[model samples]
Target: MIKKYLSATLVGLSLLAASSSSSAKVIDFEDINFSPSGGFSGQDLTQRYGLNFTGGRYGFSTLTATSYSGWGAHSGNNYAWGDGYNMGIEISGNNITLNSFWVRGALMADDVGSITVRAFKGSKAVASKEFSYTETYHLETFNFAGIDRILITSRGSGPVLLDDIDVGFASPVPEPASYAMLLGGLGLLMLAARRRKSS
Candidate 1:
């Protein structure tokens, strides 16, 4: 009976872990602490949500829609304005995929120019694409996989805007240890049931 109980518990735990590991998340730039109508340095945002940033070091500003007519808030009352086109944010873990994000030009009248998004693993470049932005916000999606870093660079000298960055990973495959624990528990449970029946 104790062995059966132990086995059942192991199976439940393994299943719970598997489910939790498969979930993904999005960063709306709304939850974190930011000065109202203020800018954040690149280092300030690094690893805030499992993401690290590099290059184009000036960072972005968090401002209200009233502060800038052209910068529309993506989700909440606030949004981020890219200081320039040269910076990129990298996901901290290995084997992450570039999912999607919302971006637009930061200027009220002039075009903000084009920006390029690139995904890389170590020194190897995996995928890249360029986008042109006007005054309106646009949602961009990517299917690049095995990415460790994502770099966004502007084609022009003007500032860019970004919001709602999403990232995902492949579903977690049960590790060998997890499988072993689960199977061992199940086998013990079955054996216990059979013994109980015989008795």
Candidate 2:
């Protein structure tokens, strides 16, 4: 009976670990404050989201019916815009897996173009892919794991728009409840062993 209970406890722990590891977080850009002049730049997302933009100027804008046609926000009323040719996003606190995101070219005369996304682990490039987008938003999947930084570059004129970024931490911090459960499981195992020894 104790052997069966031990096996079941091990299985439960395995399932818990698997579930926590596979958890992903989606950043929809809806919680950010809206800019009055249509868009704003130099905003830091590190404190709230553990992401920092560098290499090029980055901004956030609220999507409008008059300015953008055919395409709309992927999740909320706002999205991130990148100026210049290249932008680098550095992930702080922990390495993350870049699951997927929505991207498209801004709705302007010269905004149609191809964009390249590259994932890096420190200084080494791990994965890269190029995607062509018009005014319509395209869902791009990377599945790049254990990456610390992501580089996005425009192959043509005009800025790139991004929304609904999905990412998962390589090492997820356990909740207090999780810790208590782990401790309880270990205590039960110890108690079972002590009882068997006494018998």
Best by TM-score: 1
Candidate 1 residue lDDT tens string, 17-83: 7664644677776665444344322224445556564444454333333244455567774455555
Per-residue lDDT of candidate 2, residues 1-199 (tens digit): 6686677678777777776664578977677654444443234444456665554445432223222454357666766666535543444335788899998766575667787788888888999988787767889999998888887777656666778889887656577799688769777877887899899
Cα lDDT listed for each candidate: 0.65, 0.67
TM-score computed on alpha carbons, candidate 1: 0.74
Quote the positional error of residue 182 for candidate 1 in Å: 1.4
Candidate 1 residue pairs in clash (backbone atoms < 3 Å): 85-154
Off by over 4 Å in 2: 8-16, 35-47, 57-72, 86-93, 172-199
Residue 37 error, candidate 2, Å:
4.5
Which residue runs does candidate 1 get wrong by more than 4 Å? 1-21, 33-43, 59-69, 89-91, 170-172
Instruction: Summing lDDT over every window of 10 consecutive residues in candidate 2, give the lowest-scoring window.
Output: 59-68
Q: Which residue pairs come into collision in candidate 2? A: none
Model 2: what TM-score?
0.69
Give TM per candidate.
0.74, 0.69
